[model samples]
Target: MDVSWEESVADSINTIYLLFSAYLVFVMQLGFAMLCAGSVRAKNAMNIMLTNVVDAVVGSISYYVFGFAFAFGEGSNSNPFIGTYFFALKDIPNSTYDYSFFLYQWAFAIAVAGITSGSIAERTQFSAYLIFSFFLTGFVYPIVAHWVWSSSGWLSPSSSDMLFGSGAIDFAGSGVVHLVGGIAGLWGALIEGPRAGRFDAFGKPVPMRGHNATLVVLGTFLLWFGWFGFNPGSFDKILVPYTTTSDQGNWTAIGRTAVTTTLAGSTAGLVTLFGRRLLVGHWDALDVCNGLLGGFVAITSGCSVVEPWAAIICGFVSAWVLIGLNITALKLKFDDPLEATQLHGGCGAWGLIFTGLFAKEEFVIQAYDSGESGVSRPYGLFMGGGWALVGAQVIEVLAIVGWVSATMGPLFYALHKLKILRISVDEEMAGLDISSHGGYAYTSHAEESQPRFYADYARLQDQS
Candidate 1:
């Protein structure tokens, strides 16, 4: 083949990799759907599943129209708060693989938007939630993306400020995606208030167990499998700058990331199982699943940069955080049906901070210098690096928390004022499947107790 032919082949390989990675990430929606469906009561199964579907549909549209622009756009007018180009995925060359890149990002966008659905699953009105999903993808997620992932982002170590440690080294968006989704979900749930009977008059929590352990475990396994794409496929490019990297640069990153990601999830699940047994005297399958998922979230930021041992530490601590935060949310009167706060928000923060403590100097250097990111974090504490990266991580966490809470609180409250933030108490008691969507997930006599689920979703729509 000619040199030109060789170049085309290489380009095609990268393009194919990117597209396949997007597909893997896209499948995470199914994981979210099954997980949510199983974690909720039987009456809300269909609702949760539909909400997951809607997140991909509405969230993708909004991200294409607005989110991609705010996230990746840049020009003379671009600023740290947002990107000023790529609106509607416009003005980008198709041959540049922009479409494939956009697709991958769109999938990520929907995943983040979907996080809120679980926390507010049983109680949120479908209309209000669709609206929230739309804005969340179009605005909330992209804003954080601009700040965290954009090369020109002020928080990017690649930026010229030299102000903070390595401009908050999140190789894969623990903050922009996971933390953002988690906090937004938390705020939305808090505003909507706890589920009926979730907290008694004396402020004690009541048990509202999920109906299907099988589905929950299945979903967790699916998420774990898809996470191979989530972490390893996070690389924006399969090639690196020849001036800064050796021939095996991309290959090494991929291998290390996959290993670390796997170790963290596996370790966390084991730790959580033991912890739950010690604390509650039983080996809870559900807690183990959540711990595994939390471990994945916790290791995402540092997956490509941390050593395998650090992954174990991140996962081990993350398991405890998952349990502790899940309980704390209850004490705070937040009725999160799936513990979104702990899995995404709390674990994501730990991932970011732990990265600061455990990320290796060479790996961080290789990552920053490898691609167009121009990002370079200082050495982590364990590597004899100072406190700069940790400090930046803390600041970034607090800032994101404030940003999401401030924005989401008002938006949900407005929906509440408009009387759409939640389903009617009557409808909630009846179950959203029957009252809102009008169908039961199952066909057995269990449908008898599910009158609302048995209702005609098409004709009995509750738009008002």
Candidate 2:
């Protein structure tokens, strides 16, 4: 098909922003790599890194081939559950750079797969993980994403319009991306069971320390930085001194999302640090990182609607929720290596609930197009909606958690019965780095004695 010069220029500009967004999302893969590697025992460091890299590779291929079609197939179907099209990319128009759009979304599919690595690290079988990654990115993640983000999705008004009164209000994927990824992690962990010695015979929890705090910290920072792009780039409509609005509405709301996301993140980090200091008798680095992550998850759903003060409130509350969830997991004997369940599932749920409670009138009006007679969400406490919005929030939380957990529980039970979810006892003892892949992150030789030397040096300095 022939194209006009102006159309070609517009397409070129859109392609640039799309590529930039893809680059930002791609950086998240490194974040997962570092975070997962640093969360596990040093003996299994190489194995964790290998899993992350390969999951991205396999996930991208699977998502590209079938997942994209299943998700945004541009169909008129009414089903709110699954997508319609089957492997139908060739028919997509070349002018729209539909392939580029697929590439960008495919990157995000792999990002979701990466979220699970930290949860099931060390004990998960390489082969089982491969199968899980393939299915998850190709079918599971994309279907949910399409439901929330695609215009033709049943959740959107353009389609069924019956199921979603508020159109599944996931502004930045509190449920579609984070919760789906976290719930999948929860299931995989339950089937695989706790790592050996992670809990005592009496079911007492044991702390499994990371090999490198440096790596973990680095990964956390990268994720925090990449999120700037993740939340704002979701608009997918970047333009000059002012980003263009989608045909749906003015996209400048993306700026509001970016600002709120930053505020919540810092505020949550500080609260977690101090909260842990009071509880654990010291400033806990791990809790601080997770707390910041909780804030990121919490603000995601309402990034464009909630006011600055509301973002602060959401951040503070989310940190507390994150710490509580971690404690709850331990008490319940759920051994999540990096606490994926708490940071993503637990806090992600809170973000969605808070959005319903705190979403402001002006922002909502700006972003959404209700019919002349349509009713709007009452302004939250700040806007005077009071108890009504909070009540709606409560319903959203119960529905999301119950739906995800119920679907996941039986799937996990079946995988356990098949014995495909976990590595054997012998393999566990040998360490996944050696047994599963015949690789080691570190060799035992001269470096093995370095810790002793460092300890001795510290003692000598103390005496001096």
Q: Of the candidates shown, which would achieve the greatest TM-score relative to the real structure?
A: 1
Residue range with the least summed lDDT across 10 consecutive positions in model 2: 239-248
Task: Please provide, for model 1 over 1-464, each residue's C-alpha lDDT reduced to its tens digit, 9 standing for 90 to 100.
Answer: 45587667767877888888889888889899889999999878888899999999999789988898888887555898777755656566564688888888898899997788887889999998789999999988888888878777777756767447477888777887899999988888878888988988999999998989999999998888888888888876675443454455576688889999999999999999999899889889998999999999999989988999989999999999998997787788778889997799999999999988998877877677663345545768887889988887887898899889888889988998998888877678767877776566876725576443444343345534
TM-score of 1: 0.93
What TM-score quantifies how close candidate 2 is to the native fold?
A: 0.86
How much is the lDDT of residue 458 in candidate 1? 34
The numbered model that scores best in lDDT is: 1
Question: How many Å off is the CA of 172 in candidate 1?
Answer: 1.3
Model 1 has how many clashing residue pairs?
2
RMSD of 2: 7.0
lDDT of 1: 0.84
Report lDDT (CA) for all predictions: 0.84, 0.74
Q: Compared with the true structure, what per-residue lDDT tens digits does model 2 show for residues 1-464?
A: 89899777867877777777778878878988898888888868888998888888898779877788777875544245566555647466663667768777877788777877678888987877787788778877777777667776655423445232455456777777788778888888877788989899899998888888888899999888778767776666443222133343434577778889988988999999999999889877877888998899889878877888889998999999988988888898998898897788888888878887788866765544421224464445456656654554455455555555665556556666788778776567556765655446876722674565345445444644
Off by over 4 Å in 2: 1-8, 75-79, 157-164, 239-251, 369-411, 444-464
Clashing pairs in 1: 434-452, 434-453
